[model samples]
Target: MSEHAKLPQDLDPDRPSGARIYDFFLGGSSNFTSDRMLARRVLAVAPDMRRNAVANRACLHRVVRMCLAAGVRQFLDIGCGIPTIGTPHEVAQRLDPSARVVYVDNEPVAVTHGELVLAGNPNAAIVRADLRDTEEVLTADATRRLLDFDRPVAVLMFAVLHHISDRDDPAGTLRSYLAALAPGSFLALTHLTADHAPEAMRAVTELLLDSQHPGTPRSKAYLESLLDGLELLEPGVVPIAEWRPEHGDADLATAAPLGYAAVARKP
Candidate 1:
């Protein structure tokens, strides 16, 4: 058996996991057959799903680069899925060798993969903790070592919040995380939305909810509400394709159906 196959009981392959599914969407090999099946279903509704994923990931890279340019050296990436090419640490460390990053995720396999990716990398670490349990993660040993809340830090939530059902109080959950950060800290968030293609999106959303990690699309109004106290950065609250897109508008116009992406700074 492969090393990942010999993984412990907590990394259950029977039920679909958000991390594995996302990895499949990225065309990574660190996923089970179940994850690929779900990815196919998701693609059926949004044919350009892979493009959408790439676009969102590009947004993440840009945001990280911008934050680093602003002198932010610490990073807290919540809901961080399975590590892939050009992870936040990889990008940030290149900019500032002293940069520190703490990755938080609720999935055991994701945490394992993240750790494996960061192995022997003294500047980064991953903490396997529930995203909703803000207090635990904030107080966890990993956080203590990798992040210093006294100074400015960048908190990234990419394509992960959608997994949090409204019933889970995602806004409240975000507030707690924001509350932990110091002033001048940055908040980078990108969420899945059905506002563009509601009919097809509804079917895909239902399939996800019924499978394992369920989610609901946040309307523009709802997404704006999440930015209540934070100071939104330039070109505020635009489509994922419009957020500092490297490619021209024509490419983005036909790329894929995606969510809204925003980056804000706490004053």
Candidate 2:
């Protein structure tokens, strides 16, 4: 397991965090031993996890570019994990310096490292909050400062919703955020599913049940329901790897069974 030179005081190194485990799957060094341990267990059951992470991240990048191409300059990336290469802000700001982004994550390590990575970039900021709490996230100082609800904004929820349990009412939480967005705004999301490799994914989910972030991989129909009342984009909801893939992304098809992704406008 990789070790960071310094970690947040409030971070519990013994507890495995979903965000940190994702970072580990991305081959990033922002994870603790506990996180890596859990990730390894998951990989043993679902060897495609690393590839799935890559595909999910690629989907996020494409979503950002698509939103930018559609003239949406502001972004709210809720449940944004540890900041890494090809983040929404990096992609958006590179294309349009005026583009603004707000990243929200409940993990202390993610928030701390995000703050450090975003430090001098006036166009971007990170907020520490639970995504289920729409009000807190929407009203946070950083979110309000960087994003204007009156204008078109891209709300990103890549590899996030599955982490929210049914008890928290993930769909209701999503609706609250969607209701806040303007008509021209966009919602791009990716969620894990057990459609293709049910047994493997179910085992993975069981292992994560005791972690800091338990997950509930849903069905494609259920994920599609989350986009109700919005204008679904072309190609409709499909495997993450098939969502407007770019050159050299053909290999992503191998991981397509892992998750579902889609982008829609509020209309």
* TM per candidate: 0.94, 0.97
Candidate 2 global TM-score: 0.97
Candidate 1 lDDT over residue span 13-117, tens digit each: 767777887787787887777777888888897776677777777888989999999999999999888899989999999888899999999887788888889
The candidate that achieves the highest TM-score relative to the unseen native structure: 2
Work out how many backbone clashes candidate 1 has. 0
lDDT of 1: 0.84
lDDT of 2 at 156: 95
| Error at 257, model 1, angstroms | 3.0
Q: Relative to the unseen true structure, what is the C-alpha lDDT of residue 80 in candidate 1, on a scale of 0 to 100?
A: 85
lDDT of 1 at 173: 95
Candidate 1, position 251, lDDT: 69
